[model samples]
Target: MTTVNADAATPTELNVLVRPLPDYPDAERAYSRSSSLLWRRSAGAVEILHPWTERTISDSVMVASLSELVELGVLSGQEQFEDAAVQMICSSAASEESAWRAYYLNSINELDNGTSPFSPVHRRARSLIAGHEVLEVGCCFGFFALACARDGHSVRACDISPGAIDLLTTASASLRIDVDACVGNALALPYPDDHVDTVTLIHLLEHLDVQDTTVAVTEALRVARHRVVIAVPFEEEPTEHFGHLLRLTEDDLRLWADRVDHAGAEIFTDHGGWLILTPHR
Candidate 1:
């Protein structure tokens, strides 16, 4: 698979969320076993074609988590595949941080050496953090959680996808960053009530329904001693490619504030909708 720019200007450029396939023979062996799925580049987009089914795995495949991609036969599940991907990224980079930065820069066309798509939101989220102990709920790759750890916070991150958590744990260990990473759900987080100073759900609510979003916010509020921070993309329509089920707005965020008991609530926009709710003492 090839990593193409999501925002590539050309009409023919296939904009898809794909990682670079490992160059090693072991990875090649793993790819060969993937249900006869082949990446075919056409005029419009790169299609995952299954020879047996004679159909493309398109919108049906949720691109939300790494594991989902693996389940759709778009990625390999073998241990060697993971190791090879890690090795490929870490081969030439000076440090693990730089390696990840470079990977993001390539994966996301908008990202530069010093910035990512979430950098602005992360900066705001970091500033609003109540204390040093932080738990990032629904942390896909644990990038924000890792950022918090790097900034001197006791950070813990969790996601429902085991594959994503595994990748985060492996990368954290390789990066020499101490992050308590685990597999967890947003509606029912593994952490106890008031377990951390702050709980953040960055770019997570959009993927959930209204009811689940409420439950997740409640759960985050339950686990947070000081504050619960929620962020969602303010899109006109939900982006299906990224698995966003809901198009969130500031009013939707304020409704959470109305329903939950909080000492204070702040709703604003800095790249996207940000809601910071201080838990009632």
Candidate 2:
């Protein structure tokens, strides 16, 4: 665990919430186990834990008191952070056992919200772009990419998953958002040097191992001419086998930003897991 900086601003408060699935025993066990580990790690340190249990392992943690965490970071605004954290918890839980497909399906099906949990961060990044060409690595279902395109920014969305790319393309067409979606990898971006004005990555960096993350950051710098926007989950403790290679903290992100800055790029944290890095022209 990274040591908290005494000189830096401290988090405001911490809270936790839990919800148990009665039908899914395996899920309940997994959730309980993971939540316990997190709680034990974050105990009595400006954090709150919420546990929801139905049958066995009824004592389990579900949601977190995120506002305090944000306050600790010297950030304000609660509703957005709360929403993002819940979505992240759900996404992480679902991803624990290949639940992303179901999660994505449910998100798309329930479009009544128009704004997914990532909407706040996505909207923030979109607001920064004043009609610029944007590139999204690992676009998933093109949710954020489509949002950018719909906002009148030309977007090139790419993902290693062909099915994801196809779905994004199809969805973009239906929404009348002009976007170029492709199948590609983050390490070897399928774009020319300095081709895009902005590069947006949501919950992407931590998906790779440390070494791979370094390589991907290099590639993102290589392709992006102006800015790089990234969002990661800010968890108190490490969860076992988060489907990806590793989990990251603000320190990790700061180190990555330093690397980019050494390479002549400027990095800025946009609260929580969102970062905005701009390269020198």
Candidate 3:
């Protein structure tokens, strides 16, 4: 998918939200098998998906201490997800497709339902925007994109996952927010140099395999005219088959900023490391 730049000289009008949704055949390959919710605090024990309500997930701090940023249209708002997830496990008969769906359903709700379990990425990026365009790479379900749009910034979101880009675009329209959502590669972003004021790779860089390391960062820097923000789990223990590829320390971010001749901060937080970098003069 392609983004229709609102400021393009020709002044073309595009209704991306009205476009047909992307069918994610790649979901099974992109899904995770292992569970990340063994000890997460919640209002109740595992239950079915259909009857579970949003209140069920966020009402209790046990699930997550944080509240979502906006209301989610996905959940039925009735039961505890844990029980429903197990049903999904059995319904799909423990197949890879079932595992992937269950994983995404849990993960998407975690971030998109107006609250996020992760933090520190937006703390500094918001201050630096100063009314500039924003690009969110790996913007799964576009929760943060919605937050930026809510804060009155023009936002564009991209992910390699066609399903993600399409869903986020659909949700933006439903919320009456204007945003350009598209399929983009982190290693070779489609944007031109200095195209956006700021670029964000929140919890994204570490997901790349060992070999694609520098390309994602280099591409982010190439596209940002003012600031580049990167956040990753600190001292992360790699997950099996489908999660983080490596752990990152403050020193790693410092070295990355130095490569661009820019000064940056290595903010160590309980949640993660938030790295904010600026362009060289």
TM-score of each: 0.66, 0.57, 0.60
Local error of candidate 3 at residue 197 (angstroms): 0.7
* Candidate 2 local lDDT, 1-281, one digit each (tens): 12345653333443333232333444432331322322211442322233322111110111223333333342224333444344434434434223333333344333324334444556666776633899999887776776676667889999987967976676566556688999999989999888898887777776677877777877877788887777777666433223334566777887887765423433345544666677666
Task: Report the lDDT tens digits of candidate 1 across residue range 27-75.
Answer: 4433332333334334454333222111211111212233333444334
Runs in model 2 with CA error above 4 Å?
1-115, 237-242, 261-271
- Residue 39's lDDT in candidate 3: 16
Off by over 4 Å in 3: 1-51, 54-116, 119-121, 128-130, 240-242, 261-270
Shift in Å, residue 226, candidate 2: 1.2
Cα-based lDDT at residue 16, candidate 1: 30
lDDT of each: 0.66, 0.57, 0.55
Compute the lDDT of residue 138 as modeled in candidate 2.
Answer: 84
- Identify the superior model by TM-score, candidate 2 or candidate 3: 3
Higher-scoring candidate on lDDT, 2 or 3: 2
Displacement of the residue 198 alpha carbon in candidate 2, Å: 0.4
Better of 1 and 3 by TM-score: 1
Candidate order by TM-score, decreasing, is 1, 3, 2
Q: Which residue pairs show collisions in model 1?
A: none
User: What does candidate 3's lDDT look like per residue over 124-178, in tens digits?
Assistant: 4555563469999888667677667777888988999897787677667766667
